[model samples]
Target: MTKISVIVPVYNVEELLPKCLDSLVNQAFDDYEVIVVNDGSPDNSQKIIDEYYKKYPNIIKPLKKENGGLSSARNYGLKYATGEYVLYVDSDDYVSSDILEKMYSLGMRDNSDIVVCRSYAFSNNNLEKIDNEILNNDVFKRYILNRPSATCKLIKKEILLHSELAFFEGHYYEDIAEVPAFCLYAKNISFIDDYLYYYLVREGSIMHNKKYSDKLNDIFDSIDNLTNIFINKNAFDEYKDELEFIYIKHLLHAASLRFLPYEEGLPSINKVCEIMKEMFPNWSKNKYYKKMGFKYKIVCSLIYKRKFNLLKKILKVN
Candidate 1:
């Protein structure tokens, strides 16, 4: 089997596909296969994949399927992954040339199931580490109660299969819905604490094109999926405080702001307010709640008090 299966799910990313493939082909390590799944893109991404496959037949493994979302493409790629460990990379994003070698070495050294590293945002020819926090307990602090992107980690194949770490299909926040199980069930988890993955932050990206609509409600679906994961693993009681804080962070704060610019989104926002109150009435007392900044604390306070109109007015002025 290959040492690492580098899965790249391609859609309409013809322009930036070359740079991403270039980084992978020049890796310091060679015992790896690049599974490029073209999810029915109407672009030249297939031709580019064919060119790379012709040049590197043994390294570039190509697959094609019907038009599926990001989660579907990743799941399709996973079915063909034969590597000891798996790594997901977006077609529009490029990684450091030495990333595969570095992560593989660390995973082998510790026999790790998951190896978490730092990620940077690349835009305007500049890069900055987004989650550079140095916490006491690294993996839990990084994956739980934080933005868990599937692109930022190297995962063991067995642990994934054993725990059924499949990405939730048809979900906008698939990583947040599925990533916690990787950290929670791993026998050993390691941290590189270095920025190796570079994600592109620009307009028209999947995250930047946010609108106040039913799709935004998928954040709540993600939370419910995660909550079920914790319950099935019998971990909810132990991590209830962290789970409660997630409700406060996602629904009351971040997801609430998605509706801030649209007056018609008030009904859905009020529904979210009811769920938050019913499920986590004592959320303000959660210890992790205090870890947020002053501004977020004020916003959550407003949300908890059912002051949507006043909260909307206050958020608009800022």
Candidate 2:
């Protein structure tokens, strides 16, 4: 009889909102409330929400708020949520029919603070599943090394309330920064291999949308925040090597994105090189750091900075 509050942040996702809501409504789980936060979307998303609000008056509660970012919308929804367990489902994404019931049952049986499930990512022509578990006995280690997404999971409301965990305002990659910290703070965590969440990959979504030069910086900041949480908490020294691997992979991806013509001023190649050097001085040892053709990797290494000599040295060593 555990009540769950499903929070869906409604932005300008009018086209996909109905499908998302329909999936939720059709779920086998009955003891749940849906809280949809309307974050000043300019589109007819509000109209659609209103239609549903009228139809399902008792189960659906709509909270209208001015244009604050996603974090603000979620924080606003939290205030009105009355369920013992909380789940976040983006307006643009939909879940499998049994996700809520399965996640809730798992959490209840395990007395878990956080419950995670496998997720499917769908593009127009391709689909992929991400369901890897970290081998180390530590939950935080598993999170840092793999299973880093927020959408493929469920959490206990009391855990968040007791820890006072709130999303960082006006930031993208907020989940990346917050999810790891939650795992670190949690003592009871459980995972199910079953698929629950489906991330429909629109070609032009925000995360994959218009290239912004500063996007790399946002990504770096997220990694830096996640790293700081672990360091400050003094969780375990064994994670340092694994963390460096994660950092290198993160920087490489960010640095690659800078090569595209994003609107923001091109991040100084030097700044990226500087961060790569400071954070991951030696990348060859990191397991996930892939080995590319010597010159290609070296050139990529130098794209962050204008130091041809350093690139030369790396090229020579390789």
Candidate 3:
């Protein structure tokens, strides 16, 4: 069997698809297959996929399907992944050549259910490394309580199959729902300190698109789903602190985004603030909350206080 199956969900990112595919095809690791799910991209993304498929037919498998969202594309690709481990790569992003080799080796050596590595965030001509400190066996806690991105991880296929995990379809911020579940279900996890993935910061991306606020409810739904998962496993008591922290942080983020210049975003922001209050009535007292930067602390206080006008003014200034 292949050592890893790299799943790339392609949408309308025609301009950025080649760089992503090039990085994958030129990877130092050869014992892996690249499953490119063409999510009915309206652009020339399929043409690029076809080009790569022809060039590296043995390693690249292109699956064409109707336009489902990111979650659907990833879930579709999962069905045909034949490797022992799976790695998700966004079509708009690229990775270091040695990423697969290093991550795959760590997974095998540690017999880990998941292997994570550092990543870089790039925009225009600037690059910033995101170096997350990984604590022992606390991958789930760290993920929910801190950094949460599905990329830069080599996940054992068995854990995903056994957990019957699938990204929530037709949702924005689907990774918020799916990645934490993987971390929670993982038995053993490993981390490599080296920076391996390049996350492109593009203005047109889902996260940057202000109009995507309409689907903001999906973020809360995903968080609720994660909470229920912990409860079902009777792990809630053990992870309550981390879970509460995550809820508060994520709610604040959503609320901040909605508190922007757009009027349509206000309703979602208000809703998120309500949920945040209900989830953690004393969120302001959280140690993590207290440790937050002055600006963020102010934002949190304003949101908790339902001071939208002040929050908007602060956001505009910042």
Candidate 4:
């Protein structure tokens, strides 16, 4: 049986796909299979995938499907992933050659349901490692909730299958909703401090687009989905505080985006603030709010006060 399955959701990243696939092909660990999902890109990405599939016929399996977003592509890939553990690698990002060996070793040793490693951001032809401490359940909840990207973690396949966890299809910011659910379902989790994943930050990416408000509804829907999951599992009381903190943080981020000197984001920001108040009527009194940094504290205070004009000015100045 394959020890690990690395799933790469290919979209239109033709230029960068070679780097990503090359990194996977050269990994020190060989007991893994690579599942590349071609999400109906109009570019030469399929040809590139064909080249790699031909070269590594035994290790690489390519799945071609219609244009579903990242979430759909990943969900489809999961169906054919017959590994004990699964890792997600974006088409535009690459990983260290030793990452699989290191993470898989630690995961098996610790019997971890989820194994997390440090990541680096590659921008402007430079790579800077992100700093992170060791993680326990308490620390993991707080840390993963804040940085909810799915790329840096290795999850047990059983956890996903048993919990019926899948990403929200056809949505932006889907990771924000899915990663936390994975963390909640995970029992024994481990972390390594080594920088194993390199996340590329480039223009025209889904995250770097200037128009943030277009996906605001999807973001809120993700939050609601998470809430429903917590409730159905009867874990709401146990995770209430953490969930509340995450909701508030997401709201503040949306609120800050409204300061982008665009009118389209204003209504979304207003709706975010309204939902924040409705959900946590006394949010200012929450312990998490009090422990936040001065900048967030001010933002929360201004949001509670409904001082959008002043908040916009303060955000602009900063």
lDDT of 1 by residue, 1-318 (tens): 889999999999999999999988889998999999999999999999999999999889999999888889998998899999999999999999889888989999998888877889988899887863425354564566665688978998776675356888887878877887676788788889788998988777534555545677788788788889988889888778767876887778777777655676666678778888898877888787777778789888886676777877877733
lDDT of 1: 0.82
What lDDT tens digits, residue by residue, belong to model 4 across residues 170-282? 88778777788786677778877799999998877544566554665678888888788878888888877777777877665543454334566666667777887788676
Estimated TM-score per prediction?
0.92, 0.83, 0.93, 0.91
lDDT of 2 by residue, 245-301 (tens): 565554554444443334242444445566778777776565544443565455655
The candidate that achieves the highest TM-score relative to the unseen native structure: 3
**Candidate 3: residue pairs that collide:** none
Expressed as tens digits, the lDDT of each residue in 1-318 for candidate 3 is 889999999988998899999999998987999999999999999999999999999999999999988889988998999999999999999999999999988888888988988889999979998753434355667655646677888888877674436787887767777677676688787878899999988887555665645665577788777777778778888877777777777767653564455676667777777887787787778766666679777877777677877877877733
- Comparing 1 with 4 on lDDT, the higher-scoring candidate is 1
Question: How many angstroms is residue 77 displaced in model 4 relative to the true structure, after the best TM-score fit?
Answer: 0.3
Q: Report clash pairs, candidate 2.
A: 269-304, 269-305, 270-304
Task: Using lDDT, rank the candidates from best to worst.
Answer: 1, 4, 3, 2
RMSD (Å) per prediction: 2.1, 4.8, 2.1, 2.4
The global C-alpha lDDT for each of the candidates, from Candidate 1 onward, is: 0.82, 0.72, 0.80, 0.81
Which candidate do you rate higher for TM-score, 1 or 2?
A: 1
Model 3 per-residue lDDT at 55? 99
Q: Model 1, stretches more than 4 Å misplaced? A: 132-138, 162-164, 312-314
Clashing pairs in 4: none
